[model samples]
Target: MEQLLTVKKGNSRTTKIDVEGVYYRDLNAQLRELSSKGIQNVQLLNVYGQRYIGTNLSQPMEIEISGTPGNDLGFLMNGSKITVYGNAQDGCGNTMDDGNIVIHGHAGDILGMSARGGKIFVRDDVGYRAGIHMKEYQDKKPIIVIGGTTQDFVGEYMGGGILIILGLNLSEEKTYRAKFVGTGMHGGVIYLRGKVEQYQLGKEVGIAELEEKDYRVLHDNVNEFASYFNLEPNKILEHQFIKLFPRWLRPYGRLYTY
Candidate 1:
C-alpha cells in the first residue's frame, strides 16, 4: 500500500488526480488524478480551500501546495508546474497556457489573469489587478514577476506580456500602492520599483528610463525573481526601474476614413 492522501476538510470545486489512494477516497478524484498523472513532487497533505489546483495540466509536473489555496489556482494551465506554500486566492494563474507558477505567500485578485502563456513568480505582496488582462501570442510571450508591493491596477488591459513589479522593502513611501496603471494598454511591458510620486498611470501609456534592451529584460527578470524567492539579487539591482509602453499613437488623419 504505497499511497497517502488526505484532503479532509471542505469546500472545493474541481479536483482530480486518479490514483495513489485517490485522495484517500475521492477528494475530487484526487484532484483529477493529479491533473492527469504528471505528478512531480506532490505533497499536499491537507489543502483546504482548493479550487482548480493545477487545472488542465499537459505535462511537466511539480505541485507542492500546503494550505489556503482557492480560487483558480492555475486555472486553464497548459504544461505543468505549481508551487504554493500558503496564502493564495483569486486567479493565481488564471488562463495560464504554459508552465511555472510559484507563490510563496501573499497573492490575491487577478494575479496573472488572462495569461496566454506561462511564467508567474511572486514571492510576496500582491493583490488587486496584478497583471490583469495579460495577453500575448505569436511568440507566446507571457511573464509576470512580482517580488513585493502591489495593489491597484498593476497592469490593467495589458494586451501582451512581461510585467514586473518589485518593491521588496516596500516603504520609502514614495509610490507603491499603484493606481490605474496602464489603462487600456495596447501592448505589453510594465516594470515598476519605487519613486513614482503619486502614481497615476493611464491615458494610453508612456514612461521610460531603463533601456539597454530593457536592461537585458529587466536583468533577466530580476534574476529569476531573486532566484525563486530567496532574495538579495544585489538588492534587486539597487532599485530604479519604471517602464511602460504604447504612447505614440498617430495612426492616420482620422477626421474621416480615406
Candidate 2:
C-alpha cells in the first residue's frame, strides 16, 4: 500500500513534495491533482527513480527535481517545464510532444527517443542514441542541444527535427569517438562539434559544408544551451563543427517495398 505524498505549500502558487519512498503512481496522481487545482510551480526533493514525473501534464507547469529520476522522466509531456538538478535515466523524453527539460547532469541512453516538439538541454554527456527517431510537429521543431558528446548512434533513425551535439569534454586531440552516427536516418539534420572521421559515419549518412543559414541556427541554439549551463556561446561556437545529413530520403525503402 502506497501512501499519498504530503504536499507542502511553498507559497500561494508553489508546492513542494519530498518523494523519497513514494510510489510513482501515487506521486503522479498527486501531481495531477495539483495541476487540477491550478498549481503551476512544483518542487520535488529527494526524488529517486520516480518514473513519468510529468508525463500526464498537458498544460504549462514548472517542476524542479533534486535527485536522479528514473526512465521516461517526461514521457509524452506537453507544455511543461522540467528542470532536473541531477542525472536522469533512459527514455528521458520518450514521445514527448512539447515543453522544456533541462538537465544539469548526465543522461542515460535513448535520451529523446521519439520526441516531436519543444527543447531539451543537457549540461553533460549522454548515452547511446540520444535523439533517436525525433521528429517535428507543425512549425514546432523539437530541439536537443547536448553540452557534451554522446555515445554511438546519437541520432539513429531520426526522421525530423534538429540535433545539436557540442563536444565540450573531448581530449586534447579533439576527435570524436562515436561511430555509426545517423545509421538509419531518413530526415532531419545533425550538428556535431569536433572532428569525426569519414569512416565513423554510417553508409546512409553524408557530410555537407555549412552555409550562412547553418551558422545562424548554430548561433541561436548555442546561445540557448549556454544560457542553461552558464556557458559562453562565443567560446563554444568558435570550435569547428560538421553537418551530417542522410544520403537518401528513404534509406531502406526497397527493403519493405518489394
Query: For every model in order, what is the number of clashing pairs?
Result: 11, 0
lDDT values, one for every candidate: 0.74, 0.88
Instruction: Report each candidate's C-alpha RMSD, comma-separated, in the order given.
Output: 13.5, 2.8
- Runs in model 1 with CA error above 4 Å? 11-32, 36-63, 66-76, 79-81, 86-100, 105-121, 124-145, 148-159, 170-186, 195-243, 246-258
Residue 52 in model 2: lDDT: 93
Best by lDDT: 2
Model 2 bad stretches (over 4 Å): 1-12, 254-257
Please provide, for model 1 over 207-257, each residue's C-alpha lDDT reduced to its tens digit, 9 standing for 90 to 100: 888788988888888888788777777778787887877574431225476
State how far residue 200 of model 2 sits from its true place (Å): 1.4
Query: Candidate 2 at residue 84, lDDT?
Result: 99
